[model samples]
Target: MRKRIALLAACGLLAIGTAAVPANAAEPVFPLVGPSALELPLPVDGSGAREQRLSITLDHPATGAPFAGLFTVDLRKVAGVATVRDHASDSSHQCTEKDGELLCAYKGLPVSLELDVAAAKGAAKGATGEITVTGKVPGATVTPLTTKVSVGGPDLVMREMKLKKDLRPGESQPMPLVFANEGTQAAKGVVLELGTTRGMELVETYDNCRTRTAGDLTTVLCSVEGDFVPGAAYELAGDSPLHIKATAHAYDDVLRYGIYPAGDEPKAAASSGKARAGRKLGVSPAKSAPAAPGLRASDLNPGDNRREFAFHTENTADFTTSPVSLKGKAGDTLSTAFVFENKGPAWIHAANPADSLARTVVVVPEGAKVTGKPQECLAVDADGTKRAEQLGAPRYECALGNRVSENEKVVYPFDLLIEKVVEDAKGSVTVGDWGTSAPRPHAFDPNAGDNTAAVVINAKGGTGTGPSPSPSTSGSPSPTPSASVSASASASPTAKASTAGTGTTAQGGNLASTGSTVGPIAVGAAALVAAGGALYVAVRRRGVRG
Candidate 1:
């Protein structure tokens, strides 16, 4: 097939693709994902830390083509900016650099190439150079990617915040989202993004920002157009400082904040909040400046762009499933549903929108065959093995995405065809984490006994199972999050650790988002979402639930 490659630049990044090809012999176009611009730290720290990694990923991570990593990379450096170091390894295969290029030979299919890039010594701030990578795939030719390697760019760093201890529910406080451009050049524009746990809500919405929310977490992305000069510190203007409020049903929660160069922030997933009609979030010069007298290039690294803090509120949420009655004759097809509700003194959110708040595990009654199941449900045996067929398994695990508002209810309907009716054949409707099949207690719930409810099919003698519904649905104490949060494709973002002098916690991390020292949900819950887990599910969840 005749192939072509195109390198288009946008938003300080490269969108690598190809032009039109004849329909008959043409394969679908794939993009080469990598940085269009790589920044090296300015040598203001007195020691030379010139090594950085350039990761070049092909199309996407899912494509497991055999020859994906066996290609070659033609490296052409600007000579004075940086140099490519030898990175041959023995695990997959030997990779070698010869004649200003790399033969990336590998026995296994690796999605990306992590090459060592060492900046030239005495590299001053604002020094511009280039490392152009030309990849040669087995079948189709890949475009040569030119990454602008500069000595310094704007490094927007957030300030470490001292969270208030002993925060009570329903209390609102102003949080100053402060950051500064600590590099050689001015940032053309700035984007500030924040993520909050289920128990907390961003009190104000701005016109320049778009908020995407799921279970207990809400993410806000704001775009502010104006140059942020180096050496000058900034804070969200006093009148427009970000305000956070703990819901009446608040429990352990978190707040994450980061600032990126104009359009360099991570992209958000679909189904987010629309920009509101409020005033745009603006920044003002900070009252207190950095301890240093003048600006040097200490904060040019991208690793320290974001941070998070876990908070605690004394609260509880009672999660329970409703007793559902299902019936059908031997040859009858029946559709029935059971309801799941959060009886809150606190609401539950998958603070990371990508994480699952909980799961609705259904063990179908004997003598019944599942014809149609809820979307994003898995067909597995009692021990959670993948069934050969997508249906008719003894067990089905349906995901409930990360957001479950207090007093909110979700109904999962299943269509089953009865092969035979067993009088009072009982199945279970329980909640389980990603790791185990046995139902267990939620981290924030005080009442642990009632999470699982009985699904009585064709009860001849009238079965009395499951905890009865709470007396009333009105006025239940709750945390933040929506009334009805359906499952959606959710994802857990990876969090970066904090270095000295900057603020921002990690993303989509285990043992990290729960809390610093104490919080309601443990690291296991985050692991279930990030590592393990919809009609309403993201790729992260699809892998886990399926």
Candidate 2:
């Protein structure tokens, strides 16, 4: 009976074990699971904080089964934690804080949990920290999710101080003071102060500021409301002397309370104790402390901001011409050169080099006709009309183009034909006159006497010798005496004596007009006179025989 009962019990145990093996084989296997990492935006100056919402979604290989696990928020590596709130309010889950961490437990195959966190105020700028969310599955291992946070703050810097106008005694000028906020945080309730040295004054300002005068020096204090944003510039209020200094001050609330003390409230009692100690020692009490603390006033820029300028008197230009004198005879071509020079502390159109500054005019001698002139000069009628026909002594107008440098000189050559007798006849050449159509005349000529040059011409013979001179001095001389007259009048005639006197005068005139500079025109004049000699002799011999 005992053997039979033991056999039945063994069979029953075997049957139960076989049934459990199949049941265990039917269970599903799951893969890995983890939460997503996050990066939060925080200010560098520790003046501002950022809030981030994080979600941890369980990922598994099994599709049908739900996640069953426990999770915890590990904040031991995070240095600045202001607050943390659980976002599992709508779910049937409980989250409790312990040892600066949050712990939660849930039963499901695939589950998602959320958390909202904020950075602490007064956190040190550039400080880096991390928070982690770790999870555990009943049957599988899971990876932890980590997020990084950084601290930031504000930085105030002075860029430059510039003078916008020329400095002169008794004149007001604009001096711009430029400043910029370089950091990521904003600066609030900033104050700017300007102090000047003796001989400097503050006349007017665009910003609302208080001014105080001590001797010739001045002080200005101005305030700015609200916050000065990062990467923004603050320009000067108005025009002031360049000899001045500026300073900026603000309260550093973030550094004093949030970062230093590791709390949201400042240590007023500690500061109050210092004030009390001062009062007890018979010293005056200190002023009320600011809300934030780090630096009270920013260090003044490292370089010199003052500027100095020199002044000089206005400039003037003096233009002058050299003296001119010449003598010529009828039918003789005479050429003379005139020189114009500028003696100046300033050049013509010095303020603007591209403009026309002056005009030069040369009046032809009445007894002489205009024949040749410099290429830059234009022959004009007495009325100043270009290319117009004139009976005698046409005028020429020349531009002083590009001759604007100080101490510069320009030479003008004039050519003329002596048509009539001129006894010490005088002509003139003037520059910077109102008669020109040029834009602006020279400012002024210090010495007007030298601006006009005198020209003298003498035509030894009369007009009866050749055709009437053209309105222009360039008219051609009468045709050369015919070859028949030249052979017949080759012998000496009594009329030759009168002709000899005329020849002597003509030679003298040629020398006076050209001063060692003989040209083709002078040679042509000599040939014409030789031809006239032949005609004169032939006529005189005929008269003698009659």
lDDT of 2: 0.43
Q: For each candidate in turn, give its C-alpha RMSD to the true structure in angstroms.
A: 14.7, 31.6
Summing lDDT over every window of 10 consecutive residues in candidate 2, give the lowest-scoring window: 250-259
Cα lDDT of model 2 by residue, 355-381, tens digit: 445666778777777655545466677
Q: Please report, in order, the local distance difference test score of every candidate based on alpha carbons.
A: 0.58, 0.43
The model with the greatest TM-score is 1
In candidate 1, stretches whose alpha carbon ends up further than 4 angstroms from where it belongs are 1-12, 15-37, 43-50, 53-77, 86-115, 131-147, 269-273, 287-299, 320-340, 349-404, 408-546
Candidate 1 on 407-475: residue-level lDDT in tens?
Answer: 554445455567887888878788645447565777777776667877666777643222112211211
Index of the highest-lDDT prediction = 1
Candidate 1 yields a Cα-based lDDT of: 0.58
